[model samples]
Target: MIPANFTYHKASSVQDAIALSQKLGEEAKYMSGGHSLLPMMKLRFATPEHIIDISKIDGLSYIKEEGEILRIGALTTQSEMEYNTLLRRDYPIFMDAIKLTADPSVRNAGTIGGNIAHGDAANDQPALMLAMRATIIAEGTEGQKVIPIDDFFHGFYMTALEPSDVLVEIQLPKKKKGSGGAYHKVERKVGDYATAGVAVHVVLDDSGICQEIGIGLTNVSAAPMRLDRGEAVLKGKKITDDLIAQVGTIASEDSEPTSDLRGSEAYKRSILNTITQRMIRLAIERAQH
Candidate 1:
């Protein structure tokens, strides 16, 4: 199927993109990598009258650490993150997720911003962002605002982004000395959407007490889910076999999966529980060394 007739506009910058979107009103949509929007448009699930192409906009692709934050530009492709030395050295969780995100071709064109902005539970990045406790930077007519990851996903195919706002960057805290994270998902085949997935980030003190933790679940709910109950169970305590088991049960209980091609709800919950426990242990092992 082909996308319906639509006018195309190329944006020279973030400001230009926002201006075009505002001027074109609600029927206009901003597209960067087009991986997310194009397919929806082709399916007629999204039939915008105008597409403000922001792919050519400069200064929106890079990964760097500044002061206490690791800043990633919105347009940085998944491939960039996949091969980045810094990410490999300090953030193996990203590598785990990226390796499992579609194929090399999709990773080459898919931008991190689009992954999050699309607000699809099946996309790999959102849960990673949630576990990393990342922040989103959005630019609009009124200027930029920093949105916490927890507040960014409002519902299915929805986000905190206004129609006229362009997501500009993602910010994460610099990796601390004792911090580590890992992500894992159960899929039917290569590049398939997760039947269930888990991303875990943990900071362990020298004596092995868990200082901080974040647990995020994917494709098990209406939106990406942060396992708050599971995190609370482990944070500020010594990670133990018993506690890990408890958190696993909590994760399965808290997820809201529905029966589908992926699996039955019960099956997904079981996978979620198993991966949740596994990732927490992996994160802790990495943190210890």
Candidate 2:
């Protein structure tokens, strides 16, 4: 299906993108990789009058450590994040999550910023970002503001970004020592969105009690869920088989999946339980050594 005709503008800077968006109002969409908007446009789900291309804007495609934070430019591609030496050395969970994000063709073109900015519940990176407690940076006419991962997501295909704002960067605290992270996903086929996915980050004390834990669920709710129920169950307690089982039960009970071609709600919930259990175990192993 052909998309509606639209004007295109290549933005040379973040301010340029924001200014163009402000001028075009709600009818203009800022495009990075175009993986999300292009598809929606083709299907006629999105009909923007103009596309302000921000991909050519330099300095928005880097991964670097600043003080205690690891900062990633929004334009950083999934492939870059997957293969980055520092990221691979410190944040293996990112690699695990992006491994199933899409095929190489898509990964090469898709931007991490687009993944979060698109606000698609099924996108794997949002769950990972939530699990990692990342922060998103947005620039607009009013200036820049930081949005916590917990507050960035609003609803299905919705985010905190305004029409005049451009997501510029994502930052997270450096990976904690003695922390373990893992991502587990169940999909119908390669490159398909997860029917059920879970990303786990665990920090254990010397006594083996969970010091901190983050459980992020994907494709099981209107928004990617940061599972407080599971965290509440595990944190400050030694993880037992029974406790893990209870967390699994919490996951199954708390998820709000709908019946779809990939799965029924019951089936997806069941998969969530299984994935949660497996990820907890793996995360514990990683945390221990």
Candidate 3:
């Protein structure tokens, strides 16, 4: 299907993008790599009268460390994140998650902001961002504000971004000395979204008790779910097989799966339990040495 006829605008600066979005209102859309929006337009799932291309908005593509935060500009491509040595050394979970999204072509072109702004529950990055407690910066006519990753995605294909807002950057807390992170997925095919997946960040004290835990489950609900019960089961306790088994069950029980081409809700739930446990174990191993 052909997308509805639309006009195009090129934004040379952050202010320009914000102003264009504000002026176009609900009928306008922002384009980065076009991986997320173009497909939707082709499918007629979304139609906009105007597309303001932010791809040439030069300053939005960068990776930098600011004090304790690792700042990633909105236009940073997935491939850049996937191959960034600093990111891999300091935050392996970020790399682990991007490796599971689409293919090399898509990764090379798709922007981190585009993926998060797309808000598809099946998209891998949102779950990872949620687990990492990342902050999203958005600029609008009123100036800039930050939103918690947990509150960013309102629902499937929906977000908290207003028509006038342009997501500017994503900032993640830097990795500490004794932390471990991993992201694991059970995809039907190489580039397919996870049938059930988990992204975990764990910090262990000297006693092997879980000091901090973040579990983000994908394709289990309308939004990425941070499993509190699952984390509660591991806090101040050894990550033994018994603990993993118990927490895995807690994670599974917290999921809200629906049947589709992926599998039945029961099947997805069972797989989520296993994946969650595996990801946490990987995180533990990475943390240990």
Checking candidate 3 for backbone clashes, the offending pairs are none
Question: What 10-residue stretch in candidate 2 is worst by lDDT?
Answer: 172-181
* lDDT to native, each model: 0.93, 0.90, 0.87
Candidate 3 residue lDDT tens string, 113-173: 9988888778888878877778999997788989998788888788988887889999987
Write the residue-wise lDDT of candidate 1 on 223-263 in tens digits: 89899999999989999999999999999999999999989
**Candidate 3 whole-model C-alpha lDDT, 0 to 1:** 0.87
lDDT (10s digit) by residue, model 2, range 1-289: 8888999999999998988888888989989998889999999999999999999999999999989899999999988888899988888888888889889889999999999999999999888888778899999889998999999999999999988888999998777766888997999999899999999988888888888888999989998889998899998998999999999999999999999999998898898999999999988887777
Ten contiguous residues minimizing lDDT sum, candidate 3:
172-181
Per TM-score, what order, best first? 1, 2, 3
Instruction: Tell me the lDDT of model 1 at 284.
Output: 89
What's the lDDT for residue 196 in model 2?
A: 92
**C-alpha TM-score for every candidate:** 0.98, 0.97, 0.96
